[model samples]
Target: MTKKHVHSVTVSTLSDPLPSVAAKTKKTHSVWREYVKSRYLFVMLLPVIIWYAIFAYGPIYGIQLAFKEFHILDGINGSPWVGMENFKYLFFQSPDFWLVMKNTVLLSLYHIVFGFPAPIILAILFNEIRYDLFKRIAQALTYLPHFLSWVVLSGIMFIILSPTTGVVNYVMAAFGLEPIYFLGDQNYFRFTLVISAIWKEIGWGTIIYLAALVSIDTQLYEAAIMDGANRWKQTLHITLPCLLPTIAIMFIFRVGGILDAGFDQVLNLYTPGVFSVGDIIDTFVYRMGISQMQFSLTTAMGLFKNVIAFALVLLTNYLVKRSGQEGLI
Candidate 1:
């Protein structure tokens, strides 16, 4: 074949490859541009990311202590490795572990049973109230306790439950009954924890449901009324239907956190006498890590709690997804 014909043939083959290469280059540049835009937003988030990385994620390295001897002198890095020893101690050697765990679980369960539905009822009640001023007042009153530090809340409980100058004792005296030390009694301590938790945070819980209730179309309620449905029927047929998904999502979160067991409240409210009933994982950690300075043991307990919570989140999410519902993706 002639040299020109060979050259033309070579150019024809080369032309197609040049277009493909140009398209690939354009795609790479486009991706790089988009990545730059995303990086700008990521840069804006850097401060919080760094803070959490330093403080929050940094402590995650301490989780290794659960597997190590964790000498205070050696710190986390130089600590001697002792695989599963801390966990073994926690389960077998520790005297109060089960008792504390039982109390924590029971308290959390009671909160779920009695306290879980309390906010839903309160939301419905608030929704039904005709007077916006009264509704606002009730909402504010309920949420007020959530702001109070556990230290302050415990003081309030102490006053109310005290044998002397306590309103409760005063009422018991009027009824000719002996005064009871509610805070001091082991039997009452768990009850007090659950009830106080409900009282403090139930209003805050109601807020989300209230927001969901607000999102629900008023026309649905009006249509129910026009269809000769009563108030209760309207709630059953319309209000509840709209609230179910929200309730489910919230319930999953509650269940996922079942093992958490209200550390601050229990720690503040508990005394030596009622420690049997009120002590929990968080309090136990404080006792071991702070009061006792058994850092390794405390680390083990914390690691256990986190591992269980992680598993629960995964399981609950799976079940929710299997049920064909949207959950924490």
Candidate 2:
């Protein structure tokens, strides 16, 4: 009887592993079957995959150039490594480092303070609008500027802000005031940048919140109304609470880009006079890497910016999560 019991225990031990093995095999089969069935979806995504592979992941090979003294004759592979010299030069050696960092952070902070709320306010207003036709027209107009390239926008702005023959100057003349050089004046330039950025992207940004607003349960608003709540009360209590998760996620993303003041906008609009207020990490990198051919320095700067951006994103996500909100980690 003891021998029979031992044999049964042995049988049970062997059979336990059999079910696990079968389960793993079944999971693998299911995964492969799904992949086969959705091959067309993957086919549709081929261009995006190929684009990122070539343009994004493919460039990862050159990242080592940041640590090396790259020469045209020596080439990337033949370049001699300098370790952290390039990074040290970029951060400590360059006199423009602190000034450029200040400009970048200030502009980004301005955008966060003013530009971030513009879209939310616009979205809220649009949601409250009773006139569908006016809402559609206003949305279309706001969205138009975003499609225009910064180069084109800069030209339009130059014409509009011209001290001599601009409509803005004409308005100032009518008001018996001096015609201000909006683009060239250091005092007004940053304000122009912030306002233009807000105007350009406000509509596109609103689309997200508008979608969020749509997803809100109408029954909640109905109950609020039944309980003597006005539109303001309903929006404050119900709409805002429901939108918090989306707002938290978007805010985290914005915080991640705190160092990326609008590169294209500043590049097109800025001159030597405005460089103090306008030059940012991206523009700095462009001048160093493209114009001066300081490959290692520019690459190091790029890496530094990315590292800070990543760290900010992680920190912001952690904070948001701790506040019991969904974060875009």
Candidate 3:
């Protein structure tokens, strides 16, 4: 070929993409087509996407306030950066910080110890129930409290747990015992919080475990029975093994939020008398940020809490996987 012709051929060859590039372009086109085909599903998901973008991810921008000396006149962007001063104050200077941390950790541990297994046991008991009517009624009764907001529930609790005129005290009186201040006394407040939390959430928590239970193969239980396994033995082997993955995932989530010790419940239920035991990080943050207007300080507190929570989630996930279980990675 002539020099110009050869040059033209070389130019054409150079202009065309290589095989890998062409394959990637083709894959992109295929994905675009799939997305177009699923446009209706995308439309259905748009609101949820918007909600997370707005409420969840959007607020992440304000996390910088944790490091700033935030002023009301000066917005978050206008605030002067403090370079971890707020965190220093939180760790060293704040007197209530350690107290609240202790309370939060203890309450969380209590929930994990007492509250976490409650739903699983309840769900297993529910599975054992042959009477559909009774099961449904029990479930409905347990679930009713979950539907009520903490404000309303606190009112109900106040009436139910009142020292003098309450039904509990009345029952105690029948046995010639002194009326107890469950809500007001610091000693009893934590116990009251744990019990009420369990009572409120146990049924709602069971829904997931119950759903997982449904997905377990009935034949496994039958096989266990054929092998001379009684009801308890069947649960021990068949039911529990089937429930392990779900339990691991749920436990990871629970541990991730170990710092969140029920703000609304504590806020509504606790008085100054029980502040030593019942106060938690959330409540402390609320008082600092909203009630007292220590926005920067509270922002730092929140950032600290979220960092610890994130670390806990990662650690828990790692441990779960190490234990040969499915985890929420």
TM-score for each predicted model, relative to the true structure: 0.87, 0.94, 0.91
Q: Write the per-residue lDDT of candidate 3 for residues 31-149, one digit (tens) a residue.
A: 99999999999999999999999999999999999999998898998999999999999999999999999999999999999999999999999999999999999999989999999
Cα distance off (Å), candidate 3, residue 176:
1.2
> Candidate 1, after superposition: displacement of residue 206 in Å?
1.4
Q: What overall lDDT, based on C-alpha atoms, would model 1 receive against the true structure?
A: 0.89
| Candidate 2 per-residue C-alpha lDDT over 213-279 given as tens digits, one digit per residue, 9 for 90 to 100 | 9999999999999999999999899989998999999999999999999999999998888888888
Q: In lDDT terms, how accurate is model 3?
A: 0.95
- What is each predicted model's overall lDDT from 0 to 1? 0.89, 0.92, 0.95
Error of 1 at 300 (Å): 1.1
**Best candidate (score: lDDT):** 3
Least well predicted 10-residue stretch by lDDT in candidate 2: 90-99
lDDT for 22 in candidate 1 is 97
Please report the TM-score between candidate 2 and the true structure: 0.94
Q: Encode model 1's per-residue lDDT on 15-127: one tens digit a residue.
A: 98999999999999999999897997889899999999999988887788889997888788998999998899889988989988898889889999999999999999999
